[model samples]
Target: MATTVRRTVLTLPAATVGPPNPLPALRPLDETHSLDERARQGLPRDMARQIGYEPLRTLLPVRVLDGYGRERTPTRLDAIVIENERLRATVLPGLGGRIHSLHHKPAGRELLYRNPVFQPADFALNGAWFSGGIEWNIGATGHTTLSCAPLHAALVPAPDGGEMVRLWEWERLRDLPFQVDLWLPADSDFLHVGVRIRNPHERPAPVYWWSNIAVEEHESTRVIAPADEAWHFGYERSLRRVPVPDFQGADRTYPLRSEYPADYFYDVPAEARKWIASLDEGGRGLVQTSTDILRGRKLFLWGSGRGGRRWQDWLTEPGTTGYAEIQAGLARTQLEHIRLDGGEEFSWLESYGALAADAATVHGDDWSAARAEVGSRLSEALPRAAVDAAYEAWRPYADAEPAETLATGSGWGALEVLREGHKLPGTPFDESTLGEEQAPWRELLRTGVFPEPRRVTPPGPSLVAPHWRDMLETAPADPLAEYHLGVAQWHAGDLAQAVRSWERGLELAPSRWPLLRCLAVADQQGGNAERAAERYAEAFDDLCEERRDDGDSWTAATVALGREAIAALLAVRRTAEARDVWSRLRPSVLERGRFRLIDAQLLLAEGRAAEARAVFDAGFEVADLREGAEILGEVWSALTDEPLPDAYDYRMRPQS
Candidate 1:
């Protein structure tokens, strides 16, 4: 059969990705994986340079999607399927264009770990990331902020004379536009994916891209890569050079051998073909390969430890098999971000398919022979020359405009195009996509003044790009204008100016909780914990009073701010005040796993260890539990003299 693209519906138990947080992300970007001097001693110059160059200060222009809960109802997700005679691929356009499934017809087996349910977790950089399949991670070190967000999807011409589904979006974090084109050639077993990141601005931009593919993990499954050494990064936040296969007295190539979650960025030689694969004892599974430009290959494992097992269950339904990630990127490590010069773009082609080799050779004691065996099989299935030729062939079609629209993403891209007149050839962000969210900014662009809302509602989302900041600097200074200006200034790293702007706005409108919240963040970052706590309390109280009508958006703001206030109060050892703030939270909000976790913390702080222990004994899952977080174990250790329960142990690092 010829390759074809069609729309379809995938029903799964999915939690709603609730409204974004009203507050700006003024805190410093998460630098959890920072390397020590010993860990960085022998790193390549380019890798070190990129690792420190232009790291994000904060997630501005992008809001945190922390409002999602654990309750997952049956949700029908819009999907696009690309199928040929040999394979079928399912893509979810609304959820970061994730490849939800890839099935090989000939083998009658799934090539990737097809997640059974859609459960959002606090894994993405912003929040709300689900597991399994292939995820396109761009923007920065962690998962993309667009993990659960929508992307503009359309049908385009494929290089093989078939229809291709193109997923495009303007990545707000770095101000770059990118597109992912997926197509399957006729009579081929592999699925071809072409990715391009375009820097339309006049200045250089830091670019990060990673294609993360999840493959099933079994006790006998082993990952093969063409490298003798790898940069091992464990949750201990250290990176060290280690020998391949055998590391720390065990064969690390097997995902379950390790006791903690870790990353092994294989140091693929410049002359070697870039490919990575995960195969079971039978030597049958998925293999991913790409053109030369897409250089990095990595193995991310959630090991056989209790914490790892618990995390696996948290991401998907219980009783399902766990999986490990085989990823490819433009840099040698996820910590590094490459530079894309002005008016330039980076494009590459990647292919995913099923691979089968001699099980004895693949699982043999000789690592070199095992790798060579897999490489030979991959060459026979899809040659390196063929991949390069396919990339060259797809280059022309990358510029081909979409023939028809399949779905609509955020209007932020359209707003950017309208403001700057960006001539994006293939990915068009049509003005018709603009909605109420962009209305205020559109008005600001049309007129020189930033219009103030008639009602005393929470401020709309802030724009922190240089151009928007410039416009805000010139706009008439009203309370709303000052509030937004503060955010823009903060994003630009002008803390004093940002504080002044917020203070000025606070003077103009004393009861504006948004301004107070911004100032609270500034105070916290400045190390004025007491002052920050005071501001957070004031902000939460004002928000509660102002949003008494309790609209959905307002309630979100209240809950988010209230959590911050309580945490701040607890930091200062003001347990009573923290309880007060917690009490004001809506009952629905109080019932959330995140709030329940906080309740336990509050109880412990109030000298109620028994009550805190009871909270844990009653059983609750912090639905948004962050990856690598050890708070649950910490609280458990503090409360009792027992080993952490299997269900509660989600630690990803060794215990001290």
Candidate 2:
């Protein structure tokens, strides 16, 4: 670890640039009332809202404080475009080192940050100006840890007397670092936009970074952002593994929507979907620019694998998911970035989600009525010429061919990457260290049944089965060695043999998660829902205990099996009866956590579409879970009365 001191926590020098009007910066619609006064007065919020304002209030159960946490005042810039109060632009510059943090008060669903890298424990409330979900290197925790939120951001003032829309800067922390906010110009209907990086340090600094952004919501949060169209990946939707890239051409626009169980990358189109637009001072504008830093810098986006619920595919079914979370930041298990010196700054590109809903969710045919309602209201708001130019500027980059990458191989075979050494989040193994227990480990892969050596480890239980003759004897004995051999046999389509293995393993070690997982799978495969659920319950309990020591495993970021177990019970129509069990293990899903998944689920169940959207919108108010898909799935399923399955196979399989 670097012995770097907190040279400057966060210094905002608004005096040099312009006067700063700090947030909730007292305004007409949104005001900068102190947290306590807002609480006393019960401030009504409508920032990310469009539909039901009342439902939206309950959607975000945040705790607003009297004042923001201890921090410097914002540098208030003069309103350059004070043509009118409604059509004015206020700019605040010289925030060279002002560290913005989330306050505990005003606890909205979106205020999911507690502190910056400087303070890693004080989780913040979601929503507010700067949500502190910054990106970290993949190997920081061996590809399991994800940089999902933001630490700080800089909303740059537009040169034109337009709305200061573009932001460029990031949280400056010596540890857990990212140093840039890469967003597009908000006042694009006016002029060209750009930002300057002020590297004050003497030496060049290597900083790994990316932007944690939340676009305006609409009919759906699903987006169409492009990294490079020609990018390919190793995507396994069910196991929660991200797609590893295989770029081939220059540019490829990928249309990423959470319609089905997708783990692959597709191309983004040059055409932009008319998004749900805000009729502002000028008018409706299609000026969203979504881009990433991967093309030029070493950055990537990782799907959040934590946040409880086993990182379950709760919202993965067809036509249910939403959002196009573009991750050109870092791979799940690699360096996100390496700043050459202490003063270098790298920024990713931008993307705009479509606010132009073509048809009503109920009608799905035409936008004639809605279009006519506000046809030419704010033409001045859109800078068509600038938007066109941005599209053109991004064209050379967006439409370029993907970067060509050759697949590497080892003598053991190209498929060797799927070996036991291939480390993952919960594998409980070292990636660089290859231990003696690899044979049986591979055997588990070969067979679907548990290895004879009970646990995946080598020096485990050795439960001999009826088909023990197939096993070769080794000098050293393993307790669960018999289990691995059985699993390998089962995966090869020998269920009878797999059953024999499980029975034998049970004789030695009656309760085990892996075995029960296999048993539940086997039962499901055999069409025994009752038995599968029963065994899965046991597996869920065992796995929970096993992962007790692994904080990340059960972090508020990933879902736990016990949670799934409770949900599964409810899904079986146990309903009220199941609520009791659910309430007991409900801290992860119920008690305070990061994003409000349970709240989203509940809203969906109540058949409140607008409320559901508000839930998702507020949940993303702090950090974008890259979960537009899940949010859509929950609502879509709840509306259609389809209890979405917990797994991807269920999402992809043919419907009855």
Candidate 3:
């Protein structure tokens, strides 16, 4: 059969990845990985240089996606499927271009851990991430801001004279454009993927890319990589070099053997082929390999602990098999971001397929032999030379025009192209993709004035790139202009100017809660918690009064703002006012797990420990719980001198 590409629909019980938060992200960047001097003592010069290099100050130009809840309904997601004689790959273009499934038809087995549900969790850099399958992690050290967002997908000529689905987007964080070209050659068992990240700007940009492939984790499943040592990074915020396979007491290659979530970035030698595989007891499973440019290989394991099991259950339906991630990236570790010089581009070819080796050798006590066995099998299936040849063949076709458009992503890319007149040959961000969100900015670019909406409504999205910010700075001063300009200033680290801009906007539009909320964030960041609380209270009240229709978007904004208001009030020991803010929240908002946690905190603040304890006993899950948050344990300890329940024990690190 000839390789083919087609559009399809995947129906699943999915939670709505709701509207983005109206408020700009003013807080400092959430850094999840940290290494002390001792931990970094023996790191290589390049690795050390990339670590903490050009980290994002804030997630600006991107709004927080916290509107999603736990309630899931049957949803039909748009998907693109590429298939060959032996394998079929399903890509979800709308959800970060995730490869939802990779099935090996020859063996009637799935090569990837296909997620059964499309549940959005608060795990991405901008929130709203779902687990399973192969996710393209770009932007920073964390999951891409586009995790729950869409990518422009279209059909293009493949290197093997067939059609390939091209997924492209302009990553706002680093102001870089990237494309993922997925194709399968006829008569091939492996699914081929070509990735290219282009730095069109005049300045060097820090680039991060990790192809995270999740595979089923079973008791006998073991991950094999061609490395003897690895940098072990656990949730304790520490990194240390350790021997692979057998690390600590048990063999770390077995995901189920560990007690907590951890990442083992394998230190593959410079000359070794970059590959990793997770195989079951029968030595039949998925193997991922890439050209030498994609140098990093990692194993992310959610171990067999209560917290790990609970997390697995939270990401998917309960009773489903858990999974582990085998990742590849440009750097040696995810904490590092390599530099992409101006006008230069980085491209790599990756292949994923099933591998079956001698079970005894794969599960042998000798780690080197096991790795060598898998490597030999991979070499026989798809040689490193073949991958390099494929990459070379695909390079010319990367510039081929798309034959058909399948889906559209954000308009930010198109807006950027329009502003700079970038001649992106293959991955064109056409003007037609620009929607209401980019209308004002597009008009501002064409005309000298940023148009202000006639009605009193929540402001549209803000753009913080230098060009957009420059245009906003020179545009006519209106309430909306001032609000967006302040956001740009804040993102650029001009705190004083940002605060002033918001204050000016507040004066012009007294009832605009968005401006007031921006001021509140500034106050909180400046350590004026009381003033921040006051601003938050005022903002929530104004939002409630202005948006009385109880629309979904307005309700979402109200709930998000009200939660912040209540928290701020409680922080200053204003229990009555906090309760007042809580009462204003709709029943649906108050019933959410996050709000319920806030309710417990409010109760504890009001000297009602028993009631706070009851809130926990009633059992609610904070669906968007942060990766390393200790709030559940802290609240449990505060309420009583009892051990934290296993259900709520999501602590990834060991307690001191």
Candidate 4:
């Protein structure tokens, strides 16, 4: 038997190629229809306030990204195909500037999952997101709100060799600028992607970045990453402790045969190289490598059960098959938000390549061999050892933990699946069953990382009751519209009108206990002290019922509801009831960090200043709770003659 050898050089962009596929049209949501699930469930008062009491732009405008999911004329766009002798890749510059297809010429294999048609689903932090290819998530978290938006892309010459595609976008939400440069040298089988993020604002900003790579989920596929433990979290950002590669005492390899849904975020060994690869039955697949700046990796599974099929249908087109997400993050994990100093710019490099190996499982050292196997000439030119040495030298300063067992098991199924070496049988949840999906801010709220909203003042002259009222007229069944009207009325000082609006929202969706919480707020401000406390207690009980039935406290909306109820109880001097609520959530609060702030508040309410200070002091010791400490420090300093140490004055990670 003779060993097959391959060789090729870089090629230029082809002016003429095959014809493009037809863009499919998807129904877009109109004013009569809303992408918001909460609107139908009765919008909560606090959520309405969080959203600025204004209507949400749930879907992207039409004519963007092949005009899918919106009513817009389809514009003809050209796909830029960058090819070398051994590899050919196509990028759609107009469509989020994603790599549409990557093909390894020798094996004639598609390295990345190529969605045949463009389809947007309601899965992102923003309402719309597209599956397939690699989506760049920068600023905010969970599939960036801009996943479906178009990006500025241009072809530029690489300083080293060959041409590179540069995708740049100014993230409006975080007021940060982000750019991704992709290079494919002719002699190398790898595609180098370099990313740079900048906070040009005067004030500091929270930063998050993740590269979501989609690959076909095959029966024999396995994912390999150098990590001992995984930090798993559910939709609500509740981190769970589980073994990476191993789940439930069983080694659950990739292309997981388990029929249960799974999502795990792995924190690799501190000194391990950052790389994850998905291997096919023949040990050939896509490998992604990055510097230590991007330190986390995530594995997501849609499962292979009946429920899993339904989830697939819900998230993508009918014919599209199941896929796995191998994501790389820039921080400890997505939920652990990082702060970038004003005007500070951070940059990192990531590489994606296709390689074949004979081993069933690939390891850290395998990456070097894989690179060499892909292209010996390119491997020699790049010199893997030198690059690895450089990455080892510069480690970013970050607070980390060793597999904090935050939660028991993956939220998708039973813990038995982890131990039994097989996926547990269950059905995937539908949208209605999923319940209020809000961004993760429970810890921030509970820990005082985010300041509570001020008491409602008399509605200012800028009150927008008419605006909300008009929306209600158009969307009579829209609970959000009705809720917003109440908010506007409350701000406008029409206590009775505000109460009526919220009541109407509840009447439409009685399950919306959040409306009750809001109504209690209005009642308190309206001088109905006893009624306010009653409503607050009722809201608290309702949330507890739901949480108890679900066995999860990670729901932000529920937390917000409970927080409001407790705050209202405290305001009305119902200390006993507030204590009961706090008692129920004590364990979760302690595990999550936010509730500790509430505990401190309760102590202070009881005139235990020293105890309150101790609570803050203790929390400040944990890396995750440092922000909570700072907020408490401010309060402690204001209330007591004794000031918090200077350590609280600045962001300092206690010397480990």
Candidate 5:
């Protein structure tokens, strides 16, 4: 494919490690070389090279490609891990900004950032199995998927004294082959780590990826990206009460703002190449440029909260934490119509830059050239090698395990459909059923990653069926069973019942996601708008914080949630009271194209269809989601007596 821009189509095709080193690059994997079904499900390798059984097979094994379009060694690696499926991996090569910390301050532990093998994968990763034999498996889709989160697994050759390959990530044991991808192209600008799974037969196939990172707050730590300025503003997904909406900008589907404790999971724009930059160098500042295809011009800016953990007071403790992520394709696109085509592919790129040291920092005549070279090399090197090595070290998976075997013994359903990009803000859930949904943080909490629990709420669905409830009561001191039982209650519908169960579970674990969101949503349903709003927003934020378009956590959270407390109250004609809450919330509703529909409704309810029309901009301020968006068209037709919906993006993904 040719591009009008010089930078769009990259040409350099070798991996760059740290600095003066170039690793061999590989070519993309074709169907023949890719793993088959027998391989993906833990089926024994055709040529067993071990003394024991080699579980996990690969039907759709990860395929790697180098800048020169050559296939790397080992072909593919099945076991992998990732955060945002959308970012299935734009994992560049090398390990330059590599950070490997021996976390022994609070306790003795090790953390891996971009660490390469100078430290050798041959050590007791700090007395913990956190980092060991590590490898990367890049695939075609640059992000992870719902059914198949990017696979990051332990590479223990024969489980004996063989080399250990362990990548730090959140994952559940599954016998399915999820493709892994890495981007270490010859002329690459950044690194991407992603995963992809195309199985049209699986309806409601989801993107199960997210954004997460272990964190420690400091002045240099700040994040800036293109998002709704009011995102975490007054009424964001998170229950974290900003107690105010300080957002000031044009409203949009996904406004631009940053510096907050957010784990967001929103969708990629239809024209998904919008720009988002993160600072702190790595965590210092961020700049997002949403390109206007028409004008072809970009506006950029920076964000800094001056060491404030999050733009909004997420109020989460300063320990280990994850970042924001997305995991979904452009579902609402025309691609959904394609059959088992798994044709809906999502692609994007991420570039990391270091603060060029303000004028006060730079000196010397040769500085400019030096900096540029460093930037060029950095922007190139390590990432390339990292991705190259990842690709070169590939192996297809083979799973003989049945679907039943992969099913969670204590999960919500026999087979839960993959959840995708964020759903609309969900309804206030029943605290009783706070156990239905599975949280990505359960293991993180249990593994002592979070020893001191903070004060925050997670939102969304929580139900349980009678069978699970009975089992919970009979189960012995099985915290795992009890906790899941709480989840089942939430999924089954008894919100309060689930909450009680989870409450008990929390007493045992102290760190539960259901308690986080359920308590907050319950608070909302119970009538304390302030507290409810705070926690509800917090939960939403957290969910978003961990989602990627390839894995829209926020969207699902919203779909399950219904509407914001303030919006719901306003819907009930409690305008005056809602106005008060709205004042307290100070939501950047004006900046949210989605909420404009709400404004039109709120105005109409107050007998201001004329005002509503004005709010609808004579039916011009339209967005996506056809049928739903048409409600306004109907209302507007009645008011200005005009028809619309023809101007919205009513996109939809295909069902299994």
Candidate 6:
């Protein structure tokens, strides 16, 4: 361990270039009217929707403190730059408090890609995601649900002497609090980040974190990892565990021209210390390393062809190319493997800095070589005393409650006010009601069933069954895992094995409507329509029994389960059963626009075409008119043989 040598931390102004021009795709929509009105007005002539219901809320269950799509103009926002003698970091307190840019003084290179403009695209479940910089994705999937929005940020006094930028957010949906403290210690090139994720709720909830770091994507850009073997899901949806450098005799380098399409691999060794670098052709680029809290290191590619180029253009300004993400997560592979107990405060440390390799053959588990090349001094572990001191001083802010500093202000807006002698109110976290175990079957639910391939299936569960079997060994009665095992078996055309898995899951949790639905679907797909009908009826009955009380807390799960039961029943021509299911859940179906579309679907199935058309016409009154109209179009197409309007044609849709 390196000896402790505390130095004063200095905060400076932003030194990066102009607020870059925003891409059309990233531009915020004109919100003069409600979403319902805009949707009725319809999307631009160039845009087209798909066959399913576009979500009413861009991201479900997001705590809309103020309003949706309330984005701050980047150019007008101020930035805070934290630096040491060796490195300078530009943090945009407005841009999710992200490390907007990192510059290594010696190399005079931007270790982190700095976007010229703050551009947000419709890539996130929240309806807005920006390119460039390190984005902290927490709580939900698809970019934290607040990627483009601002987060609360402040400057923390580090006990080790450097000034640290602290960013915190209270994720409402999951009732959890997450805080990140970033600092560039004096005389060190490495940027140290300490993270604290606390479940402030009384019940354990599902939470995930992904530090998405983007670097310049060029022909020379190569992704480096410390693993000899790599697992990747090819475009064909087959999860293949292959060599790191060469996968089936092809080099899977960045800006790749191979047929792999997009890369999302994370079958890393358990003991391996996860690190990924988006290296420039010249052997220098951004590098991120973390402790076991972040076990999954991922690299996403946009490809090298025109399709890739168009996606790049969507994220970046004209002439400015798109970049790839080198993400690190705190789970075994991705989200859902680990769960936090109520009132549990999980903390981890991560180090980021610039790295230059003598050669680009930076594959294999030789991190020592890369560490040595970056200056052996940079990789030395901090003295236990200094690390302890730093962790202690910064721990209080993790539980610091947000005050009404800026009236729903995000980023460092409120923190800046606190610096002016105003103290924010913080409630002490109570552990009295804390639970020992997190939500069961969270991992299986989060990962969902197997990937649905377009044409022929992959080697099916036989190739991946061992992985599920391994999970079963770890958690013998995990209903979700058992359900996934059934999915894998069904994909392999083993109806008997699939049925047994489903039966096991049901035995563990008899009221699991989802498992029953899955079993019913499997039977239907296996040409056993009568059996499928029986299973569907059973699932519908279970759903009704579970939520028999009208006052039961309703969620999307309830709505979805009801719809699924109805669909399964209708598939087997059980119209009366479908209607009965709908009658029971109609109130919920009417409450959410997305589910209303399903109601219209049932109406169409019942031969009430005029009523279904009227249901869609009623979309004009919906809050998110745009999404409502899209669902209306999908349902309209199903009710008639008539070709969709020019705008609703699937071929006219732009690829996301």
* Candidate 6 residue-wise lDDT, 65-100, digit = tens: 111121224445556667777777776655566777
Two-way TM-score contest, 2 vs 5, winner? 2
- Flag the better candidate by TM-score, 3 or 4: 3
Candidate 3, residues 342-391, lDDT tens digits: the string is 99999999999999998999999999899999999999999999999988
| TM-score of model 1 (CA atoms) | 0.98
Q: What is the RMSD of candidate 5?
A: 22.4
Clashes of each: 0, 136, 0, 7, 195, 11
TM-score against native, each model? 0.98, 0.30, 0.98, 0.50, 0.30, 0.53
- Stretches of candidate 6 off by over 4 Å are 1-59, 63-74, 234-238, 259-261, 335-337, 360-656
Superposed model 5: Cα runs more than 4 Å off: 1-177, 180-452, 455-488, 492-496, 499-563, 587-589, 618-629, 649-656
Off by over 4 Å in 4: 1-78, 235-237, 360-383, 386-656
Query: How well does candidate 4 score on lDDT at residue 10?
Result: 22
How accurate locally is residue 266 in candidate 3, as Cα lDDT from 0 to 100? 96
Listed per candidate, the RMSD to the true structure in angstroms reads: 1.3, 20.8, 1.4, 21.8, 22.4, 16.9
Off by over 4 Å in 2: 1-479, 482-499, 538-559, 586-589, 592-628, 631-656
Residue 155 CA displacement from its true place in model 4, Å: 2.6
Question: lDDT of each prediction vs. the true structure?
Answer: 0.91, 0.30, 0.89, 0.53, 0.29, 0.54
User: What is the Å distance of residue 453 in model 6 from its true position?
Assistant: 48
1-656 per-residue lDDT for model 1 (tens digits): 88888999999988898888887878644545566556666788888788887888899888888887778899999999899989999999999999999999999999899999998888888877999999999998889999999999999999878888999999999999999999799888889999999999999999999999999999999999999999999988887789999998999999999998999999999999999999999999999999989999999999988888989998988999999999999999999899999999999999999999999999999999999999999999999999999999999999899999999899999999999999999999999999988988999999978988767777889999999999999998888899999999999999999999999988888457999999998888899999999998888888877884778788878888998899998999888999999998889888888888899999999899999999999999787788778888888888999999888988888888
Candidates, ranked, lDDT: 1, 3, 6, 4, 2, 5
